[model samples]
Target: MLNTALFMQQIREHPIVATISIAAGTILASEVIWKAVKFFHSQLSGKRPLRVHEVLSFNELGDICAAQHLRKSMPGSPELTKSPEPIVLQCRNMYCSLRNVGKIVEQIDRAVYSLDVAIYTFSSLILADAFKRALQRGVSVRIISDREMVFSSGSQINVLACLGVPVRMPITSKMMHNKYCVIDGVERVEEIRRLKQRKWIRPYCSVVVSGSVNWTRQGFGGNWENCILSEDKELARMFQADFTRMWKAFEKSENNLKQE
Candidate 1:
C-alpha cells in the first residue's frame, strides 16, 4: 500500500493532479460518511420509512381476498394478476350507493365505444337517464335482463326499447339475480357470487362480490349489502370472459326458443 504522505507528495508534485485527487477524495469521503450516517440512523432511529404494502379500502381488500379464495377452492378459470393491490375504494351506506351511482353514471356517460349491462333489476330512473344519454352519444348499448322478473325493470326496459337500446332477455327458468354491469364492453366485470340467501335484511351479510355493484336500492337507508369495486384490469378481464360465455349461451337459448 502507498503511504499517505508519499501519495500527497506525488499529488503535490503535479498541482493539477493534486486538485483532482483532493476533489475525488473529498467526494469519496462525503459518500462514505453519508452512507455511514444513513446506516447508523437506520439502526438508531425507530422511524423507518412508511412502507407502502398495498392500499385496499375494506371493499378492495375483500376483492383481493375473495380472488385468492376463488383461486384456491373454486372450479373457475384462474385470473390474471397484474398487481397484488386489487382495490381502490369502498362505497358503503344507503347514500353511498346513490353517491356511487352518480360516479358510475359519469363513467357510463364518458363511455365512447359500447355499454353492456346484465342486471337483475333495472328500474333506477337515474341510471336509465344515464343510459339514455349514452345512447344519445351514439354508444352501442346492449342490455341483458332476467326474463322472469321484468316487473321492476319494466319501465326501464320500455324506455330503452323506445330509446333504441338493444335489450335481450336471458332465457332462464330461474330468476336472473346476477346484477353484473359492464361498461365499455366488459372493460371491467364484477363477479357477484351468492353466499347465502338470507331471510332477515342484512347489508351484504349473506352475499359478497367484486364488481361495479348491484342496482338494489339497499344501503344505509335500505337493507344492507356488501360488494367490492375493482379497477384491476387483470381480474376484470377474466370475469369479462365469463360474461361473454354466459351471454353467448343465453343468446343461443333465446334463438332456439325463437325457432321453436
Candidate 2:
C-alpha cells in the first residue's frame, strides 16, 4: 500500500514524465494496430507482393523499392550484377554510393574521343564546364536535351551551342525524357587515364551510363537518384542508335522550319 501511494505521488509530481510515458505507449499500440490492419488488408486483397527481403526488382521508371517489407534475406543472383565485366554502378540516396554529379564530371573529364549525351533536363555549371574542357581536348561532345527545359534558368544549352558543341532538341508536346550517355564507341572504362597509360590498351568499346539520375543540383543532392555505367557494346549501340535518330529528327525539323 505504501509503495503504491509513493508511485502515485511520483506520477502526480512529474506530470511531463507521465505524459511522455503515456504518449510512448500510445505510439507503440498504434504501430501494432497499423501493422495488424496492413496484414488483414493484404489478406483480404489477395495480393502477394514481393518484399524487400526478396531480390531487388527495378521497374522501367527507375524505382526499385516496391512492396518492400523489413526482413533478413540473401542478395540477388550473381548475373544481376552491373555486367559480366567492365561495368560499374553508381547509386545515390541509399547505402554508400558515389556522388552522382561528381561521377558525371569524372566520366566527361575522362572521355578520350566522343561523348553522346541525351537527357531530359540539365542546369549544372559544373557539368557544363566539364563539357567545355572535353571540347578543348578535341573530344566530340554532343548533347540532346528537352526543348522546353533548355531555356530554364541556369541552363547550359545556349552556352554549349555557342561553343560549337552540337546541341539537339526535339519539338513535341510530349517530353523527350531520357537520361543516358555514351562515352567513346565501344567499352566503358571508369579509369581512362590508366587505360591510356598502357600502350597496348586501345579504346575497344564504349560505356553506356543510364538511370533515373539527371544532371542537376536537385537531382543529385536533393532527390534520390541512381545511375548504371556499363561497358557492353550492345547496350551502348542501342543508346547510340536512339541518340542518332533523335538528333536527326530534330535536325530535319529545323530544316523544315527554315524552308517554311
Q: Which candidate is the best by TM-score?
A: 2
Please give the distance, in angstroms, between residue 198's alpha carbon in candidate 1 and its true position after superposition: 48
1-260: candidate 2 lDDT, tens digit per residue: 99999978888999899889989999999999999999989855534342111111122423232113111112564434546421113333242222334455666777787888888888878788988999998787778887777667877866787787777777778887898888885422333435567545444346677888677766754566677766555677788788877877888443332122
TM-scores of all candidate predictions against the true structure: 0.49, 0.54
Candidate number of the best lDDT: 2
Q: How close to the true structure is residue 90 of candidate 1, measured as C-alpha lDDT?
A: 25
TM-score of 2: 0.54
Report lDDT (Cα) of residue 35, candidate 1.
94
lDDT of 1 by residue, 1-260 (tens): 56988887787789898888889999999999999999889845534442211211223222323334345434443332433421211223323434445455555666555566677666677778888888787666766667754545344755676666656676657776666555443332122112234344211101112333445444211444444444344444565665677777677544332232
**lDDT for residue 213 in candidate 2, whole number 0-100:** 66
